[model samples]
Target: MPSKLTTVLAVGGVAVITSNPGSGMHALVQEHQMGILIEAENQQALNDGIAAAMSQDTTQFSQNARRYAEQHLSLEGVMRGYEQLLLTC
Candidate 1:
């Protein structure tokens, strides 16, 4: 479960600049509709992506992030996903 700090501190949605492109965490972040992705290999692209992400610090993003967390990242959300996975197995 995400702590209060995680919820309160995260105002800029989510993003990661990494060389490992399509890892599990990246996929999960994308799947949950959290934030943008920037490739670590390209400085110019990363900078532009960061600028874009920074510019999108709006109420809509917050609302969407909160909704996504509630639907897929919260304790209940995690438990629900886990339960569904268990049933399939």
Candidate 2:
């Protein structure tokens, strides 16, 4: 068994893992702000999984998350009732 840590990305909606602070983790975190799941089975497996994710097309994942956020958490929609705050000096 191996130790692990799971991180949740609030904005990107991506989950990634690594056994150490390496390129596999670096790429995902840098490109997509992917949440980190750490210390998986071994360094190799963790690296491979992240690498596989990199190879696959993530268009559907991105689109779904974006659509959901836009509909339920749009900035404009969230601030609609705070117009007076912006006007105040």
Q: Lowest summed lDDT over 10 consecutive residues: which window, candidate 2? A: 1-10
What value does the lDDT take at residue 20 in candidate 2? 54
After superposition, candidate 1 runs with Cα above 4 Å error: 1-20, 56-61
Runs with alpha carbons beyond 4 Å of true place in candidate 2: 1-49, 76-89
lDDT of 1 by residue, 16-52 (tens): 3343467765565455555565665788878887787
Residue pairs with clashing backbones, model 2: none
- Model 1's alpha-carbon lDDT is 0.61
- TM-scores of the models, in the order given: 0.55, 0.34
- Decoy 1 TM-score against native: 0.55
What's model 2's overall lDDT?
0.50
Q: In candidate 2, how many Å is residue 23 off?
A: 28
Top lDDT model = 1
**Each model's backbone clash number:** 0, 0
